[model samples]
Target chain A: SQTIHQWPATLVQPVGSPLSLECTVEGTSNPNLYWYRQAAGRGLQLLFYSVGIGQISSEVPQNLSASRPQDRQFILSSKKLLLSDSGFYLCAWSAIGDAAFFGQGTRLTVV
Target chain B: AQKVTQAQTEISVVEKEDVTLDCVYETRDTTYYLFWYKQPPSGELVFLIRRNSFDEQNEISGRYSWNFQKSTSSFNFTITASQVVDSAVYFCALSCSRVHTPLSPMDSSYKLIFGSGTRLLVRP
Candidate 1:
């Protein structure tokens, strides 16, 4: 079985502060990883995806960026957090022709 | 451009009743894929079903069934004898198949374009 873990399940920061959210997958290799954001009562919006280490694709360019430093590790970072950045962030991993396994998600609140 | 539309923004149903969620899509390419996912109250997504363009035959798994209409470009999902646990936000997704191609930057490997999602509430 595979499992995904995300740290700092919840965070609150003032506007213009820095942001970092970490995600890691275990029990799978060379899996497709994705980052998504969901606003309150809204559908998910794709932020970024990675096929391999150091290879990242930005679905919607904004104040956010993603990095895959290791095969199983993915990180979402921002130099300055904006009020619009507040949302529920999710990380997912999937194999070929298979379902994606999602993380518990990180709830970011920018004050 | 490819897009998915889940017209029903919210649905409320009583326990043990049947409910159907509607999804319509638009795409330029003829060959593509469709998917359904469930997001529970905990905010974790769970994959429910995947239907390729060639597969028009409907599928019934346990209490869930999917209707794929190629002519209309619609994929709908239904829950029979629904329970409280079935309450969740359902999303319809579209993907472009990358067949027999090496995984590369240009090769689009099942990239999902999701809909706005429909929220379902089952009351006991």
Candidate 2:
């Protein structure tokens, strides 16, 4: 069985602070990883996705970035957070031509 | 470009009643995939079903059923004997399939474009 772990289920940070959210997958190798953000009452927007280490494709131009340092470790980061950056962040993984599996997600509030 | 449309913004139904959520999609590619996911108040997305473009056969899983119509570009989901546990926001998503191409980290075809979700509320 595969499992994804995401940290700090909830976080409250002041504006302009740096942010780091981690996601790691177990029981799978070379899996596709993705980062998504969902605003309140809105659909999820894809932020970034990676097929391998050191490779990332960004879907939107925003204040956040994503990196896959290892085969199963993905990180979402921001040098400075904005009020609009607050949302529910989710990490997902999938094999080629398969449906995605999602993590529990992190709720970040930028005050 | 690929797009998914879930027109029902919200729906309310009493327990034991039947409910259907609509999903319509558009894509230029002949080969593609459609998916439905559920997001409860807890906010984790749970994958419900996936249907390929070639397979129009409707599927039934327990109390859940899916209708896939390629001509109409619609894939609808229905819950029979709905319960409170089925209350959640449902999302429809689409992805294009590219054959024989190496899976690149930069390939846009590997990405899924999601639609604005429909929130389902089942009353006790």
Candidate 3:
């Protein structure tokens, strides 16, 4: 079975502070990884996705960026966080022609 | 452009009542995929089901059921005898058969475009 782990489960960051949220997948190799953000009462918005290591695609222009440092390790980072950056961030993985599996998600609050 | 629409923003139903969440999608590709996901208040998304464009057969699993209608371009989900545990936001998504090429910076055909989600509140 495949599992995705994301942390810290919750985060509180000051405005303009640096942000780093890590996600890792187990039991699967070379899987497609994605970063999504869900604002309160909104749908999950795709922020970034990677097909392989060092291959990251940005779906929407924003204050966040994603990296695939390893085959199954993905990281979402920001040099300076903004108040708008607060949201529930989710990491997901999927194989071709399959539904995506999601992690527990990180609730980030930038105050 | 492929788009998914979940019409109901929120639905409140008493326990044991049958509830159906509607999903409508728009896509130009003949081959594509439709998916339904459940997100509890805990904020983790749970994959419920996936249906391809070629297969329109309805599926039933335990207390959950999915209806896929190609002619209507809709894939709806139903929860029979709902419980408080069924309270969550449900999202519908669509993806085309087109392969993603990193060279093309503007193409997201290979990615899933999610709907705004329908929040279901099942009271016991």
lDDT top scorer: 2
lDDT of 1: 0.89
Model 3: docking quality category: medium
Which candidate would rank higher by DockQ, 1 or 3? Answer: 3
The full ranking of all candidates by lDDT, starting with the best, is: 2, 3, 1
Q: What TM value does the first chain of each candidate achieve?
A: 0.98, 0.99, 0.98
lDDT (tens digit, per residue) of candidate 1 on A57-83: 888979999999999999999999999
CA shift at A82, candidate 1, in angstroms? 0.8
Q: Candidate 3 regions off by >4 Å?
A: B99-107
The parts of candidate 1 lying over 4 Å away from their true place are: B29-31, B99-109
TM per prediction: 0.91, 0.95, 0.94
Least well predicted 10-residue stretch by lDDT in candidate 1 chain B? B100-109
How many clashes (backbone atoms < 3 Å, residues ≥3 apart in a chain or on different chains) does model 2 have? 0
Candidate 1 local lDDT, residue A88: 97
In the predicted model 2, the residue pairs found to clash are none
DockQ of each: 0.57, 0.77, 0.60
DockQ of 3: 0.60
Specify the highest-TM-score model's number: 2
